[model samples]
Structure formats: structure tokens, C-alpha cells
Target: MEHQTIKRIAAFSDGGQGGNPAGVLIAETLPGEAEMQRIAAEVGYSETAFLAPHEDGWRVRYFAPEIEVPFCGHATIAAGAALAEQFGGGRYRLYLNNGDISVEGEIQQSLAAASLQSPPTRSEPVPEALLAEALALFGWHESDLDTRLPPAMAYGGASHLILPVRHRATLKAMQYDQAQGKALMEAHGITTFCLVHAESPTRFHARNPFAIGGVYEDPATGAAAAALGGYLRDRQWPHHGEVEIIQGEDMGARSLLRIQISDQPGGSIRVSGTARTIS
Candidate 1:
């Protein structure tokens, strides 16, 4: 039997040390669902995006090491960079199973920078029981949480629980059991728990426990970053208008993500970062 092949790329990093890695599989036609899942597991990244030619542009599907996801932002960025490298810097439209989205890539000063527009976003208040469980899992007390941000389940492309902590130290010391956390996330239908600490009006720090993706943590999460921007917009958080997210510091893999938001309500937000080839 011929095994399907896929390419791997790291997204949202300057030199590939601090970005979320994803597998980009481009094939004449997508294999069976089981085969895709098997390949994703073998690749062992947070998520793998598979692309196939379609009528409009490309039909895309994202699969984590464990399961298929509705959408994935970091992988989308990687896919965009991959496309730009192969075809030239330009915009690409993607049709996901859930909705339509777009990504753009360009060469800026000899570096590859890509941006992705997330799907429509929405948020819901976090339940008391769920909050308590999450705090226990991370060994954080209620006092550690930021009262201003208020915990909520936010979704742009995928669902994530956004919990703002009061202290940067609390955000830095993130830990959880893989099995237990995965069970909790699956039970709650969440992709990851986004733990954050605000550094300034426009800058923030983030840590994501992507247990559902069969990974202990994500170095950088574009989908969660987009969701975070939408959440802040909904609450009208004070900022310089642009949000900067710094992630993966605790893991020794530092990454940076920039989000641009508009004044319009429910407007699509842009997430941008630089990507370098891993090979």
C-alpha cells in the first residue's frame, strides 16, 4: 500500500523556533477520512490542514492529531504561506466544512508574512461549575482570575474558553494533566482553554492548553488569538485599537501574533504574523 505524503510547516514565527507547527497535505484528491486521521496522527502536530483543488479555490479540512476540527487558524496561516511559496504572494480563498474564509500572504523585507480572516465570532458566559473545574485543573484560585475580563467561551473559527488572569506569574505557571484536561475539553466541546494575562492596554500574554488536540500546549494559536480579539471587541476593551499577543514564552518558544480589529460590529478581524520554513 502507498502511504499518503504531507508537508510540514511552522506558522507565526520569525525563524521557526516559536511558532505552532502544522502539517500541510496537498493531494490530487483527499483520501478517506480514516486515512487523513491516520496521517495527522503520524505527523504529530497540533493540527494538519489538507487541501484539494475545488471549483472556487481549495477545499480545506483540518485534523488534529486526535480528531477533525471545524477550522484551524495557525494551519490556515501555514497553508497560506505554503501556497505563496509555491504560487507567489497572493490571496487565497478556502472553503471549510463550516464556512468560508480567506488568507493572504506577502513577502515583507524577504520574510514571509501571512494573515487570515476568521469566521464570524460569538461569545457566551462561562458557567460557574466549569470555571471551578478549570481553575482546579490549572491549580489556580479564583483570586488569580481577572474580574474585568470575565471568563467566557469565545468562538471565531473554533471554540475556546478565554480566562484572563490577574497576574502574569499565574499565566506563566500553566500545567494540567493531559488525559484529564482532554476529557474536560471534550466534555465541554472546547478546542482549548486560553489562559491570558494583560501586559498593557494593547499587549497581552497567552498560554493555550490544547488537550483536545492531543498536544500538551500550543506555542502559538492563531484561532484562539482571533477569538480573543473578537471577545475584546464585544466587551469594548480599551486598547490602542490593535492587539498584540505574545505566546509560548513559558515553553521557551516565544511567538508573536498581531490582530487588527475594526469599529464595525461583528466585523471580520485580521490575524497576522511572520512564518519561516522549517526545513
Candidate 2:
């Protein structure tokens, strides 16, 4: 049996204390799908990222405890940090199962700073039936939704249901039955439910229920965040070209993610954050 070493790193850390943890494996070649799946389950984190050198950059893949995801923001950030530590600071291209992206990383003040250019984004209005089912799962009323950002099926790299609440309290009170939510998400091809509140034009709070990936919640989700940025762009929300997201505070992880949005519709969003070793 062949085994590859994995590094545990947390991305989007708040002052080196809290962030979403991910496992990063970099080797000459990626492991077989079954082996990678087994490793991800054994690691038991929200996600694990694997990397191997490709034509001009690296091939990347992300896996959760139970299944694979199209793209994972935190895991990519962790991988970028790991690559920076090993090969020095620079921008690197990443080839994924469905797309290509780039990551820029550097070590600054003993922390890894990385930015990932997300896949192009698009959003669609949420179906009424799906919206109703989601509301029931979270015990929220339609009135609780923020009219500023209507619910949508948003996709940056992977798909997510973006539900913006009118109040921060509603966002904080998010809860759902894991099994039921998982079934609903899988049935609808949703990666997670990105429940959020707009604190201001430039600041937002988010909670992600990642039932499809077999996690109850994600402290920080870059893909969802990017999707939100793009969705806001589509809705003509006054984002002012940039936004900051504070997530996972309720779970004590306190992750922070910064995003830069472009004007072009379906443009790529740049998601950046600091990372540190879990250690």
C-alpha cells in the first residue's frame, strides 16, 4: 500500500486562532479515487485537498468525508499555503475535475496569505417549492428572507442555495436536521445552503450547512462566498466592488474571508484569506 503525507492547515483564520481546517496532500502524483476517499473519511475534516504537478501548474481535487466536491475554497487556500511553504511564494494554476483556477500565496508575518480566483459565477432564482422546503428545514419563514438579495441557486464552482436573511439573528439561529437536509441538498444538486445576512454594503455574515458533504456546518466556505459575491453583483446590490465576510463565529471558528468582485456578469471572484498550521 502507498501512503502520502498530509498536512493539516486551517484557512481563513481569524488572527491565527480560528478557521476551517483542511487536509492538504501534495505529491508527484495523485492517489487513486478510492484511496483518496478513504483518506478523506479518515481525516474527518470538512474537506481534504490533493495536488500533483501538471503541465504548467498543479492538478487539484477536493473530497469531503463522504463525497467529492467540484471545487473547495478553504481546501484550495490550504493547498496554496502548503505550496507556498514548499516552493516559495508565487501564483499557481490549478486544474480541477471541471475547471481551471489560480491561487496566489505568500508567507507573511508567519501566516500564509492566499487568494484564489474562483470559477466564473452564475445564479438563478430559487424555485418556489425548493424555497419552501428549505424554509421548513431551517424553521424560517419566507418573511425572514432579505428582500435585498432574493434566494437563488448560485454557482461559483459548485452549486449552493443562497438564502439571505433580513436579520443577523435569523442567520445565527440557523439549524436543520442533517439527514433530511442532506437528502434535499443531494436531490437538488446543492453543495451547501449558504444562509447569510448583509450587515452592510461591504460586510456580510454567513452560515453554511454542508449536508451534501456530510458536515453539519462549515465555519468558512470560499466557494459559497464567491457565489454570493457574484449573486450580489447580478442583483445590483451596492457591493462597491468588494466585500468582507465574517463566518463561523457562532461555531467559535471565527473565519474571515475577503472578496473582490468584478463588474462583468459571471466574472470570476477573487477570494482571499490568511491560513495557519493547525498544530
Candidate 3:
């Protein structure tokens, strides 16, 4: 039997630490869904990206250990880095389940950095009841929220609920029952709950609870960061053109992400971060 290799890459890492691990398999052709699921289960990361040549670029699918997801940001970053290593750094088009996206990868010094153009983003108000449930799940009250940013459901590559907290300490102490959070997220059609603390107009800290995908938390969530950028753009926040996010600090991973939004409404947001291989 021929030996197969799956590259393990940490996306959005802070140098060598604080990034989310993703399995990247670049194949001549994609395997069947069952086989891909099996591979994803074996890899056991928050998500694995399966890439194969397609119409104009590559067809990509993301899977968690338990289920397939419509889109994933960090895995895309890892895939970009993997592609760069194999084919030399440049821009590549990715055909996802919903739409086409692009990632540009390059080696800067020792770190592999990639920036992805996310799908068009939009946001809507989160229902009061759902907001209350989320607050209860995190043991947070409305008073704990940052009044500047209201709770809302935002979508870039995927859907996420954005809740801005008042203090970094509150964001750091995020805790919830995995099973209960899974149920809530699935029931509410939310992929992740983005809990954030705004450090400044251009700086923020975030924690993502991704129970819908059977993960307790995500160290770095590029999709959520893009969604947040769109949300801020939609609200006309003083983003000043870009926002920087620090994640996984509470969990000691300390990942980093940057978001740049276009002035156009419902435009694709750019999410950029550095990736490194995990030995």
C-alpha cells in the first residue's frame, strides 16, 4: 500500500504558538465523502481541508471530526500555506460549497502568511430571546456587554453570533457546557459564538465557542474575524479601515488575525494571518 500524508498546519499562530491546528490534504482528486469523513476523524483537528483541482482552481471542503462544515477560515489559511509550500507562494482560487474565494500566500522571513478574501458578509440583529440564552450560557448579563457593539448574527464565510463584552477579563473567563452549547448552537443555526473584548478602535480580543462542530473552543477563527469586520463596516464603526484581533490568549495559544474591510456594502472582507507547520 502506498503511504498517504496529511499535513498538519497551525493557522493564525502567534509565531510558533497560539494557532488552530488544521489537517490539509492536497490530492489529485478528492475521495468520496465517507472517505473524507474518515480521514477527518482520523486527523482529529477542529477542521480538515480537502483540496482537489477543479474548474478554474481547487475544490475545497472542510470537515470536523464529527461533521462537515460549509466553510472554515483557519483551515483555508493552512491550505493556502500548504499550497504555497508545494507550488510556490502566489494567489489561488478556492471553490467552496457556497462561493468562490481566493487566498494569497507567501513566505515572509520564517513564517508563512496567507490572506483570504471571504464571501460577501452581512449581519442581522440577534433575537432578544436567543441573546438571553447565550448570555445565560456564558453566565454573562446584559450589563456585561459592550454597549457600543450590539449582539448580532454575522456571516462571512460562515454564520456566527457576535457578542462584545465590556472587559478582557470577562472574555478570558469564557466557559460553557459543551453539550449544552452544542445544542444551543445547532438549534439556533449558529456555527460559533464570537465573544469579544474591544481593546481599541483597531484592536480586539476574541474567543469562539464552536460547539456546533464538537469543539469546546477555537484558538483562532478567521471566519469569525471576517464576519466581525463586516459587522463593523455595516454599523459604520470607527474601524479606520482595519482591525486586528488577538485570540487564544486565555487558552495560552495566543493566535493573531487581521481583518480589512472594503467600503462597499456586503463586500468580501480580507482575513490575514500567519501559519506554521506543526511537527
* TM-score versus the correct structure, for each prediction: 0.95, 0.98, 0.97
lDDT (tens digit, per residue) of candidate 3 on 1-279: 021578999999998777999999998998899988888888888999999999879999999888899889999999999999889999999999988999998877667999999999999999999999999999999999999999999999889999999999899788999999999998988989999999999999999999988789999998999899999999899999999999988888899999998889999899999999988
Off by over 4 Å in 2: 1-4
Give me the candidate number with maximum lDDT.
2
Q: Estimate candidate 3's alpha-carbon lDDT, on a 0 to 1 scale.
A: 0.92
Superposing all C-alpha atoms, what RMSD in Å does each candidate have to the true structure?
1.6, 1.0, 1.2
Q: Give per-residue CA lDDT, model 1, range 67-105, as digits (tens).
A: 999988889998998888777899999999987999998
Tell me the TM-score of model 2: 0.98
Q: Which of candidates 2 and 3 is the stronger one according to lDDT?
A: 2
In candidate 3, how many clashes are counted? 1
Quote the RMSD, in angstroms, for model 2: 1.0
Q: Which wins on lDDT, candidate 1 or candidate 2?
A: 2
